[model samples]
Target chain A: MSINLNRFNRVNRKKIFNRIERTHKTAIPQAPKRPPLLHPQLDISALTDIFLSKFSASSSTYQSIDCISLVPQLVLQYTELHNTNKTLVTNLQSLLTLDKSPLDWPDALTLSTPPATGEQALGLSYATTAIAETGSLVLCASKQNPTTVNFLTDHHIIILREQDIVPNIESMWKQLSLSAEHMPRAVNIITGPSRTADIEQTIQLGAHGPRSLHLLLLAGD
Target chain B: MVEHYKSNPQGSASNSTSGPHQTLFFKAQSSHALLDNTLQEALKKAKGGFIEKRSKAIADVENFESYKQQAQLVKNHTLDHLAYYLTQFEDNLIKNGGQVHWASTPEQLNNIILHICERRDAKSVIKGKSMISEEANLNAALEAAGIDVTETDLGEYIIQLAKEPPSHIIVPAIHKTRQQVEALFRNAHDLGDRELDTIAALVDEARLQLRQKFLNADIGITGANMLIADTGSAMLVTNEGNGDLTATLPKAHIVTASIEKVVPDLESASAILRVLARSATGQPITSYTSLLSGPRGIEDLDGPEEFHVILLDNQRSQMLGTPFEEMLKCIKCGACLNHCPIYSAVGGHAYGWVYPGPMGSVLTPLMTGLKQSSDLPNASTFCGRCEEVCPMGIPLPELLRQLRNKEHEEHLTPRKTRISLQSFMWTIQHPKIFYWLTQITRKVLTNTTLSQFFAKYIFTSWYNSKELPKNNSKGTFMEQYKKSSKQKKT
Candidate 1:
């Protein structure tokens, strides 16, 4: 059954707002209002350095790729280095494909078509946006780019555009609201790969998700 | 209430009751905890890490006060206008094809979850760490309904396997040593002839097992660190990424959040996020901080089909417009717990509740009747460290004193304490008699010859556990001050 919103509000209204009512008009001081901020302008290109260095400091690796033609070679190189068999790539559902990249790719590149049963050693995803302030990648899950592709695999790789990187998280929200009517179900703001410091409080990466996150930063508008 | 569930072949430990939150009897529990070598040893390892890491994180920022102020301001303003924000979030979430449910009590929350799972014919549910869920006793409730619930956070998973409650908010299995965990795995995981000696091996094993569960679970439940009113997004920050997997994998994703977690905008959320990870784990940022609003969109390839947000108000509304209002600002960073000497000494289980440490002292008493948990407030030495280190600037000691005052008002404390306080107040009113009595007693008690014998006789019970201070040979400070002044005049 759906929640009884009217009943819920009716019960909580007295308990919640009544308390606020008493305090709102009373002697308890309020924070002095400040003018709304206009966040400063910065060279958007310079954010690449900020994003890459910060991302790397958190143990995530990043590199620049000139074209999608080399994506297959990169995937093969990554698997061979890690001593793995297959790489789970997303639906090739990114604008990177729009830039004259080949329609066909390597044999090792397999689609996460039937949903991964953990046989794939690596995952490649297409990120919608990346934030410079925290050096985070923003992925909005759609049928083309499944949420499972981000979490289930051992190594998670992303293809991010330089122009798509926002200056801060607030701007990212503005970007999301622009497409608000068609908001994706899950907006995963991934800062780094999976990690845990639970055992004796010492951090160990690759807890339940990917061990390492590799970003292929495309340095073009 | 402390009933045990029968163990099954799946190897998931049958929970013995929900958890061992001893809401009452803080004194005895803490006493037992204080004397436990294992807990103290674990504490010895954990104590320095949180403190040092948080301080370093705080120091890394140039002006940390701005972040703190921003967080405090957002929380204060939101609480002041909670109705407006809450309604905005509800409208936004509903507009996004998501439903919001309100639970005035823990039982209501449980029923709502059960209804969803049962309707969906859910056989298995994977859960991320939610303190509110623990407070609601949701695990036991779900299991009683025969839903296969798995805890996905590493610490939470360990405690679940051992059938124990979390000892720390961030690190649920903070009380567990590696050796204990090894034994637990040896007992539970049928890794026939597998050698699991190190923490790494144990983590890898849990990863392997939980990965299977994550793929197969019907529904996923998680706790939200913050809920954005503007976007209708339930925000979760986790280092493990289990929260992401849980919310992403299942056919339905349910977010259990307290009413106070609602924030007005994304900027406000950013302000809190800057301090949250640093204070909790000293990280610049957690690995995963997902903002899940609705279920999978019409064109989405993979994600849960349905999304539900459960807003729980478990006695937190009673706190509003009161002296304890500031407490709701707490982000559950466990900074207060880490810096707490009392918590460091006795550990979380002794406090006997979902919350432990200074915050728990105020909460356990306030939420679960002050009289039942009168000892919780008394457990603190009131060193004020909790307030000093609290990221939200909660006045913890003052709140404890408030509980202690309530105890006295209700006569929850023993008659002997009341009589002693009354006598003390009576003596203070008559200053001349108080001086005379004090001076005479000082002379008699400070008599070096009979002092030890008299002290031994008068404070027998106290002497059982502690040594009396060495009797001062010098007279009272007032007498010495008078003599010094006379000599100075000469």
Candidate 2:
């Protein structure tokens, strides 16, 4: 049965490729003829500032915390401000990975579960990489970092190390390609919270995903 | 030939073997749409927003044209070697524990989906914006089979409730005003006696309703903006992130995509991505651009257990070698639709299909055959705005002209147009004779007003809608030339 299937595949492949031969110009992939974007020389700190401004312009908010201890304080500040009950936390306490978790984090945060639907008001997640050009957070799903925490909540908060910022999407893609074999289940390049302009071309935030995205940028040595 | 391809760009489930022959009424539909007060009001609100946002986004970018060139190059190269990249994508998907299915016809595609859903006994399915699914009429197929299907996108959900196919490629409910949406919500949602007049309330109501449906859905299906061959990733970009919930929350995820959506690598995908959202919604990037490769691995906390991708060729394989090949490069950004004056005037429903406007004009005829939707190709004024704003640099007007030529060759156009065009062609071939003949005609026209009896007969219905310009007393060009020569002699 397997041999028959393989033979079927071979013939099918032959026919498809033959169709391609009649239609296409057989050209190998080439380097881009010209650069699409000009990357101005901005040091890490300067790029961080640009990323912050771009984020705000895109309707996302951010704050630079002096230390890791400040994240819990920021969380309390947001929780009190928004009047949310439970906070969904993903990958914040994974021991297998070398990435550290918040040391004195409280029990207010929980893991993502099905159809808390609108019940889960606030979500806190750790960013894999922060893209500087578009002000996007690169979130990778793992055993600890359930991807649901990024989407299911009404308000989402992300923690990022300042050093992990990449200038462009291409730069990040190139880096990710190096570790191709160990790719996670999903990788989301998220810019702002959920939004839609589908109705009469009117823009609305938090259509189905989070209403607002808040970033807690941590300084790295 | 007339029966070969028919129906709207959004496929009808009834068009299994024999396609829907409904798109032939573009004339009657557009006429009615022109006078529709509600649609005109809706069009007004939706108007200028897309154009303004797009211009602002383009102004922000330094070298937008160069990016378009790069995108065109990427698409052209991938299309040339589509079979290779498709197989590579298939192999990678299989390796990542995802399944790939092939479908050549809409019937076959629908059957494959039904088989998968039946095997799992899927009760309900959540959907993202899959134009390919729309092309196959998947929702009709699923609903007919006793499966509850919900569209998660805010626009799609609104249109789905109203029992209307998407008028625009990107914004399905672009034809609907907020008041109409409020009425749709009041009628559809079980939460009755609720005041839902505002857009925010409508969004909140949908969010609450779809939020429950997403969690309980047995299967999730979505469209791909671009499928990455190297990584076996089906990337989707959306502002709402409903696609993310649909894919991650469901037990089984099915991707319904056209075969031409594939690109060579992530770099090429990024090259196109830079221009896609910038042109589509004028965002640097959407809220979410996800690369969901396969089913959940053991390391992942929450995602689908089974990942299936259905690559539907339909008539795209035949389109590959034809002049219509450029139509395959469309990313379905709706830029052409947004920029078109005819579309802005009549709205999406007037086109009478899942796809509308300039892109739909070329695609509807190509996909649904020249005879059934012969009016669509002629519907355009050849304004060239669609081509000017197109991110893929598709020659929309030239392609429309090719479709017109096909219509002329097939004798599908009206006898009057054929005779007029034939005469025009013959006259153009003989310039001196044309000039002499035009000199006599111009003398008559110069002596007469547009309201003349002969003018009424010549212009016919065209005169009824539009008044011609006043007569020119300067006589014909040949007479002027003769007078100039006489003056030179003096």
Candidate 3:
């Protein structure tokens, strides 16, 4: 009943390896590389105003607030407002911080990275809009940026630049293709949080992933 | 002792073929008694967990709807030309140095698997959770042939220890409580003084126990989620990674799957994967989605040497070209089970055979003879929930109704019930007689106390869980309508 492994050894290994290599090579295409820099000395107030206007179109829940004074306050409010479970906030805080015990992270999260420390959160970046079709997230994780900042946190606060919003999944794919590297190492399009109904169909939010998603659409300054 | 040993003359003879009504009545009573405690517990615990998790999982993805649609389209496309895809899949499997065996019936399938085991001199077989194997009763057949078979999936392993069939397709031990599991484990395995109170501990114990069997087994048996025709690969998606070990560790790996599992390519497989886990376990992706091609190559460090796929038709190919073809699109994700009210109440085993929930209600009578299992098709409330949540968009309620119509047309219904319905129909056609009969029945029931007693005793099944409605002493609505019409004419 045993198959002759020696017969297919050389040819099969070559075929499999070639296929993997080909897929990897063709996965990303070379593009015009740009420095990883946020636009400096930009009119933050004007950008915030535009973001707010777009936010109102998609969601009716936004309220007018002073951009300079209310930014941090609104962040806290939105975080609490979006998250129903208090435990998620605690979990997120622990995950976002560096030097946290690895055991505190869930199995799925642990598979991705070890627990993060407090200093690591300073390097994290966020993006708001992602194409709904292909499941590619608009993220800005860099070398100084630990991958854990985006994934490990219980509460993910994504501030969408109003102009960055695309029409559909195809548009997002187009945008992703414009990147210099062609494809990021990982792109997680998260619509919701970590959840499981395995306990008996009772959807306990934040089972193993983010329990809440908050979108801060900055409107006209 | 006499009561236990004596076979009642009224009882159905083991050899005699009886109508579905008699068989249903006997089996229903027996199963009711057997499942009373189990069903109550299962129903109470079935809801809340999976439902919430799925919604959260879907919420995480903005394009969950599109993914679901793509998955549905892929499944529909595959099912539309299943015959061609099945042939392609079989051919590819052969080309990859694997064997494909076709079985038209469960008996034939059981024999084919047993033959494989015998030829390989398989002493112990490690199996992943396979609903198809359950449908074929393969384990019993193997055990009967004096072979040791172990179910490796955590849920399947738990149910196997209890010597019971799977209660849920995804989580086979959905019905068993922690206490029940502790008792089962205590009785079956020697865990010493280790605490079995927590869910984690029980899972750990089962993992440790099954790990050894996975390493030692001569043969590994698993079910395929999708059989990719273009690539000659059998795809298995699991959260625990047990299926990977089962398929790779054993010397010979045997896959039991229906003919409709074939998909066109990896893209189609990926599309279906998006919905499969979300619908079943509410994960974006399962822990392992292993695509196993023809055994291990020389360069491969680990994998089975011999690969055999037993493609069991088991009435599925017959279902093709028929009105029931949509059923072939089922991926066995158990989403319908999670949403089904009846399955939520009675669980899988109460259906009295393999395959349960809405899918089982349609499939059982088709696989087993319609005459022997006619009640299953009629057992539905026709809520259409199963159809609503089905990832493949299978019109389950409509199909169930069609089967019911077929059963009625075939005269498989009991003679007494048929005659009663015929008389009722005749009375309805003759309105005067119908009204007169209705009034008389209402008057008799209202006036006589004995009538209530007779109804209570005679129609016990109807009144068992519910109180009888109060008798309508008022005349028929049609009679009153006629009087009003006459007055208007005057």
Top candidate by DockQ: 2
Question: Candidate 1's error at A182, in angstroms?
Answer: 2.8
After the best TM-score superposition of candidate 3, give how far the Cα of residue B441 lies from its true spot, in angstroms. 5.0
* lDDT of predicted model 3: 0.60
Q: For candidate 1, what is the DockQ-based docking class?
A: acceptable
**Which digits, one per residue and each the tens of the lDDT, describe model 2 over residues A1-221?**
01233343355445545555556555442332332432323455687777777778779888887677666667767877777775655455432242466455566655544333456777777787877778898888776567788899888888888877877778778656622335577898889989998887889998999999999888777
- Residue by residue across A113-172, what tens digits does model 3's lDDT show? 222321112111345354333222355223323233443345545544445655443344
lDDT of 3 by residue, B240-309 (tens): 5467567766889999887678887655776787778788877655534555667655434345678888
Candidate 1 versus the native: TM-score? 0.90
Clashing pairs in 2: A143-B299, B5-B368
Each model's Cα RMSD: 6.3, 4.4, 13.6
For model 2, the superposed segments whose C-alpha errors exceed 4 Å read A1-18, A24-45, A93-102, A106-118, A178-181, B1-21, B425-460, B480-489
What are the per-model DockQ values? 0.45, 0.46, 0.04
Who is ahead in DockQ, 1 or 2? 2
Query: lDDT by residue for model 1 over B14-104, one digit each (tens)?
Result: 1233355466777788778877998888889998898898888888766677777777878888887776777778888988888888776
Q: What is the TM-score of chain A in candidate 3?
A: 0.48
Docking class of 3: incorrect
